[model samples]
Target: MTTIAVTAPHAPSYYAASGLPQPARPALAGAVQADVCIVGGGYTGLSSALHLAEAGFKVVLLEASQVGWGASGRNGGQLVHSYSRDLDVIEARHGAAVARSLGSMAFEGAAIIRERIERYGIDCHFRPGSMFAALNERQVRQLEHHQALWQRHGHRELELLDAAQTARHIGSGRYKASLLDRSAGHVHPLRLAQGEAMAFESLGGVIHEASPVVRIERGDPAVVHTAAGQVRARFVIVAGNAYLGGLEPQLSGRSMPCGTQVIATEPLGERFPELMPTGHCVEDSNFLLDYFRLSADRRLLYGGGVIYGARDPAHIESIIRPKLERTFPQLRGVRIDYAWTGNFLLTLSRLPQVGRLAPNVYYSQGCSGHGVTFTHLIGRVLSEVIRGQAGRFDAFAGLPHLPFPGGRLLRVPFTALGAVYYDLRDRLGL
Candidate 1:
C-alpha cells in the first residue's frame, strides 16, 4: 500500500568494485505482455527468470536497480546449506513430515549453484568447502549435533575436526573445533549474480533495470505497474525479498528487513595461506556469528553482526574489526580496503515465507541470513510451481509464518533486545 522510492545505487563493497562488467539495461518504457513477470533483480528474481525462461516461458524481469544490486550481490558468498533455522528446529517446530519434505531440498540449492557455475561457465571464483568454527565446547557440541542432523537429512559431506585438525585448516586459535562441509563452498557473489543475469537474458528473458514495481492489480492476468510502464502477465513472481518495500501488505507484516555488514582487507598475498590454508569459508557457531573467507585476490572478506532494522551502521569497520582481530590477532592492523552493508529479510519463524498473494501472484521471501543458496533453489521451485509441478513448492509454502511479536514500530528494538540476550548467552557459553 505504501510506495517507497528505489533510488540508491549499489553499495561500494568489494563485490561491486570487482564484479564482472555488465551492460546497463534500460527501464521499462512501454506496455509489455509475457507469460511471467518477475519482481526484483536479486538472486530470487534472477533465478526464477533464468529457470522460467529455460522452461520456454516468455519472462520479463523488473529490477529496482541493476541485477544483483541488493543482497544477492552483497552477501557473504558462503554456500551455506539449509534455511536460516536448521532441519532439526523445523522437525521440532513442525512435524517430521514437514521437516522431511524441507530436508529433501536442503542441499539442492548448493548443487544448483554449482551446476549453474559449470554449465554457464560463470567465473565467480568458486571454491569448494566451508567450515563451521566452534569457539567453545558448547559450540563444538552444537557443531557435532549439526553434523549429525545434516547427516540424517542425507548430507554426508561433513567432517568434525578437533582443535589440532582445525588449527591446520584455520591458523586462528580462537576456535576449539570445527566442522567442514566438503560440498559447501564460496563464490564471488556479485560476479555469480551478474552471470546468472546474463544466463537469464541469454535464454530470451527480458530484463528492465531501474524499474521498480509500484503496485500490482490482480486479475486473470496480473497487471504490475512501475513509474514508466506496466507489465501484463498470466503469472507474476515476487522475488524482491528485503528490498520489496511496501508493495504487498500481505508479506510486509510477517517479515522485517535486517542489515548485515562486511569488510574486505587488502589482498593477503603470501600471508593468505597462514590464515586459511585450505581456502575454506568459515562461519562460527554462535547465534550472532562471524563468517570470513579468502577472496579470489586473496583478501580476507570477513562479515558478522546484524542490524535488526536494516539501517546501515555509521562505521562498519569499527563494528567488524574487533571480531576479525579476535579471530586472527596477527591481522590486527591489516588495512581494510572495503566495508559495506546489505539487508536480508528476517521472518519470525526464521524460515522463508513462500505462497501466493493471489492465485496468479506468487512470492518467496524472508530467507533471514541464509539466503545465498536458498534463494536460487526457491527460484527454481517458483518456476516449477508455475509449470504445474507444485509438490516441492507446496512443501515450502505450507510452513506457517508468524508476525513479529511487536508491531512495526516496536519490532526492531524488541529483536535487538533478544539478540543482546542471546549474545550474552553465547559469551557465557550457555
Candidate 2:
C-alpha cells in the first residue's frame, strides 16, 4: 500500500484563494475518548458528527489536514440528485419498492442541503440552477430518457431545453439540448464544509485538525492511532474517500483515486453574464465531463480533465485550459487566476459505498463526483443505522463492490485502459 505522508500543502487553489482567511487550526495534541471518532473532517465526517452529536453521542473528529482540505473543499460543487449511473440500474438490481424509496432519498438529499443552509444561516453563495447539457443528438436522446424517468418518479422540477433554448440560457451553441433541475444548485464547497464543521463544533463535537489516523485496533472499544495522539471510541467512521490510503486497504481496493482539475478565471464583470447568462451550473454529457459555473462574484469557475496519477497544478492547468477555451472561444485571452486538482473515488457501480467494516466501524464513500449532497444524507442515515434503524442505509449498503483487479500496483493502469475506451466511445458518439 502507498503510505507516503502528505504534509506539504499545495499552493492555494480557487477555494483557498477566495475564501475568508481562516486561523491556523492546531493538530491533535493529547489523548481523547469519545462515543464516536470520525477519521476525516470533510463533509461526510462533519455531517456524521453533526447528526451523532445532536443525537447526544460524544463525538471526536480527526482530520489529517485542516477541515475541508480534501475533495470536500475542492469539488465542482454541483449538488445533483443522482449518481453517474442510470436510475434503471438501481431499479433492476433492487426491487421496485426499494428503488423508489432510494430514489426518494436521492431527491431528499437536495432538500437536506437547502434545509441545512437555511437552518444554520450558512452563506456559501448558494444559487439554484443546474443544467445537464447534451452536445449531440445521442446525448439529447439520453437526456429525454432521463427526463421521463425522473418525471415518472414524481420529480417534476426538471425542465428540458431544446438546442435554441439551451443556447439562449448558456450563451453557447455547443449544446444540443439540456435538462434543467431548478432545485439542484451550486455553492462554495469549502464554505459549505467549513460551515457544517462549525455547526458540529457548536453542538459540542471535538474536532482535531492535522491528526491522521495511523492504525485501527477494532474491538468493543476501538482505538485509533494518530501521529501525535490516540482516540478510543465506541464507534469509528472512516469518511476519507479517494485520499484515504493504507488506513483501510479493503475499502480502498473498492475504489481508485482519480484526479480531476478545475480553474477559476478572474472576475469577468459584465462579461460574466455573457458567459453563463442563466447563472446555472453547467456540465456537458460527455463521459469525461466538463463542468462550469459562475462564481458568487461573477467569475467563470471551469472544471474539466481527468488524470490517472498524481500530478501538480501546472500539469493540471495545461490539460484543462484548452478545454475551457473550447467551450468559450471568446474568452481565449482570459487569464486563469487559480487552478488546482482534487481526487474523487469512482466505483464500478458508480454508487456510494455505505456499510459497516465492523459492528462499530462504519464507512461511507465512492460518491463518483456526486457526493456533495448525498454524503450529508448518508451521514444522517448512518446515524439512523447506529440507532438500529437501517432501512435507508441498507439501500446502498446492500450493493456489492469489487476490489480493483491487480490491487494497488496495477489498478491504475487497468482503470486507465478502461477510461481510454470510454473516452474513445464518447468521442465517436457510440
Candidate 3:
C-alpha cells in the first residue's frame, strides 16, 4: 500500500554510495512505439529488455524512479538460487512434475548473471560462493535434505560443511553447520542493475527513468501510460515487484509488500579476514534470516528482519545492529556507516506469481525474499514467452497463487501473527 514515488531517489545505503556511476536517463516525454514495453527497471525488466533487444525486439523500459532504486538495489546482494519457498516445498504443494520444471531452471538465473557479466564485462565485483549457515541441529538436518533436494534437481556444485568447516568460511561460531554452493555468489547489487541497464541500452533498448506508469490499456497493442507520455507496444511486461502500487488491482491483492532492513559497517580492513575468511556471502538458517557478506572494500554489510507492511522502521540501525553484533560480538560497538530499508513482494505461498494479465500483458511478481536470482530467470522466461516459447513460462504460470486469507485489510496482521509463530519456533529451535 505504500506506493513508491515516481521521482523517489535511491535509498542512502552502501550500494548507492559505492555503486557504478550511471547517468540520468530522460523520462518519457511523448508517445513512442516498441515491440515490447516493460514496467519497472529492476532486474526483471532489465533482463527482459536486454534479452528481448538481443533477440531483435524494440523494447522500452519505464522505471518509476531510477533503475534499481527499489529492493533490487538495496538487497543483501547475495546471489541465492531457487525460490523463497524452496523445491521440496514446491513438490509437496504442487507435485513432482511442477517441482521438476522449476528445479530445472533453479540455477539458470545465476548462470544468466555470470553470462551477462562476462559477455558485457559488467564490473559488479562478482564473487562466486554462498553459504547457508545453520544455527541448530534441526536446521542442519534440514540443510542435509536441502542438499539432496538440489542434487536431485541436477545441481551438483554443493558441499555440506560441519561446524569446524563452517568456521573456516564464516568467522563466527554461531552456526552449527552450513551448505556451500560454489555456483552461488554475491555482487554489488546496484552496480549489477546498472550494468544490466547499460547492456540493455547497448542492445538498442530504450529506458525512461522517473516515468511511473499510470495504467495499462490492454489490447492487441497495449498502451502503457505515464503522466508525461505513453508507450504503445505489441506486448507489455509488468516487472515492478513491491514498488508496483495499485497500477494493477489484481497484482496488488494477492501480494503484500514487506520491508527488510540492512546496515553496513565501516571498512573492516585487516579485520575482514577475521570475519569472513573465504569472502563468500552467508545467510543463516532461521525463519526470519540474517544475511551478510564482505563488500569489495571489505566492509561488513549485514541485513535481517522483516516488516510485514513495508513501513520504515523508526530506527533501522537499532533493528539491524543488535543482530549484527549478536552474530559477531567482536564488533559490538562498530559504527554502522549506512542503514536502510527496502520492500519486496511477499506472496501467500512464498512463491513467485508469474502469469498473464491479459493476452498481451504479462507479469511476474511476489518473489518473496528471493528476488536476486529468480528475477533474472523470470525475465528470460518472459522473453521466451513473448518469442512464442511459452513452455518454460507456462511451467511457472501454472503455479497456483492465492491471495492472503484476510485480503488487504487484515493481511498484514495475519502475516505478522504467522511470522511470530515461526519466529517463536526458530527461537525454541523446534
Candidate 4:
C-alpha cells in the first residue's frame, strides 16, 4: 500500500485574517464511543455532525488542528453552483437521469449554503452574486450551454451576460462574456465553517481539536485511532479530502493533491470599486483558474496556481503576484499583507468521489477546486445515506477514479507532469 505522512493545517489564511479572535480547544486524549464518528472538522465533517446530531444520533468530530483548519477555511471562498467537472462528463458516465439529478443537487448545494447562513444568522459577509466569466469564444459557448442546462431544470436564477454586460458587473475587460448566477455568491469560509462547528456542538455533538487520526480498524464496529485518543463508533465518516493521510490507504492516492496559494492585499479603500465594481465574485475560465474577490474590509484576496509533487510556500508569492498584477494593473503598487497555500484533491475526471470503502465506512473527497460548495452538499447527502436515503449519494457512488500513478515515492512527479500539461493549456489559450 502507498503511504504519505500528514501535515498540519495551513498557516494564517485569509479566512483566519478576516475573523474574530479564536480560543484554543483541548486535544483528544482518551477513548470515546458514539453513534457516528467523523474525521476532519472542516465543512464536510461539520455538516455531517450538524445533520446527524439534528437527526438524534450521537456524533463525535475529530480535528487534527482547529475546526476550519483544512481547505474549508483556506479556500478561494467562491460558492459557485455546479460540480467541478462538467455535466457532460457526468452524463457520459452516469446516464441522463442520474446526471440530471447530480446537476440539480449542485444547485441545491448553493441553496443549502444560503439557508444555513440565514437560519443560523452567520455573519460571514454573505453576498449573492457569482459570475462564471469567459475569456474566449469557446468558453462563451460553454457558458451558454450551461445556462440552458440549468434553466431547463427551473434554475432560472442564472442569466447569460454579453461582453458589455459582463464588463458592467466585474469592470474588467479580461472576460469577453460571462454567466451570472444570482443564486450563488461568496462567503467568509472560516466564519461559515466555525458557525457549523458551533451549531454541531450546540446539538450535543462532541468535537476534539488537534487530534490527528492515525489509523482505522474496519469491522462491524469501526475504531478511529487518533494520536491521543480513539473513537469507537457504529459508523465512520472520512471527510479528510486531500489530507486523508493513512486513515484510509485505499483512498490516499485516489486523488492527486495540488497546492493552491492566495494573497490578501492591504485594504484597497474606495479603490475597491476599481476592482470588482459589481461586488460579484469572479473567476476566469481556465484549467489553472484565477479567482479574486474583495473582502468586507476591501482587501483583494487573489488566488491561483497549482503546485504538485511538493509543498513549498517559498515560491507562491512570485508565481501568483504577476497573475494578480495582470488582472488589475491599477493596483500594481498594492502591498500583499498575507500569502498562504492550501491543498485541493483533484481527481482524474475533475469530479467528486463519494461512496463507501466498506458498507459502514463512508468517504467523500476529490471535489477539485469546487469543494467550497460541493463539500457542504456532500455532507448533507452523506447524512441522508447514513439514514437509509442513498438515492442522492448513489448518483456519485460509481464513477471512474484512478489513483495517482508512480505510487507513494513518485506520486508527486506524476502529478506535476499532469499539472504542467494543464498549465501549458491555460497559457496557449486552450
Identify the candidate with maximal lDDT: 3
Per-model TM-score on C-alpha atoms: 0.98, 0.95, 0.98, 0.93
Q: Which stretches of candidate 3 lie over 4 Å from their true place?
A: 1-6
Kindly list the per-residue Cα lDDT of model 2 for residues 1-430, writing each as its tens digit. Answer: 4233344363378787666445456676668899999999888998889999989999999888888888889898888887666577788876787678777787777788888899888878899999999978889998999899988887899999999899888878888899999989999999888888887877888888877888988998999888777889999999998878879989987787778899888888876456777789999988888999989888888998677654444666677789888888888888888888888888767788888889999999899878888888888998888778888888888888867778778877887898899888878877
TM-score of 4: 0.93
Candidate 4 lDDT over residue span 85-116, tens digit each: 76766788778887778877877777888888
Q: Count the backbone clashes (under 3 Å) in each candidate.
A: 0, 0, 0, 0
Tens digit of lDDT per residue, candidate 3, span 1-430?
3233456778999999998888768889879999999999999999999989999999999999999999899999999999999998999999999999999999999999999999999999999999999999999999999999999899999999999999878888888999999999999999999999998888888899988999899898999999888999999999999989999989999999999999999987886457888889999999999999999998899999999989999799999888998889889999889999999999999999999999999999999998999999999999999999999999999988898988899999999999999999999999
Evaluate residue 183 in candidate 2 and report its C-alpha lDDT on the 0 to 100 scale: 88
Which whole-number lDDT from 0 to 100 does residue 222 have in model 4?
Answer: 94
Give the per-residue lDDT digits (tens) of candidate 1, residues 62-125: 9988899999999999999998899999999999999999999999999999999999999899
lDDT order, best first, reads 3, 1, 2, 4
How far does residue 336 in candidate 1 sit from its true spot (Å)? 0.9
RMSD of 3: 2.5
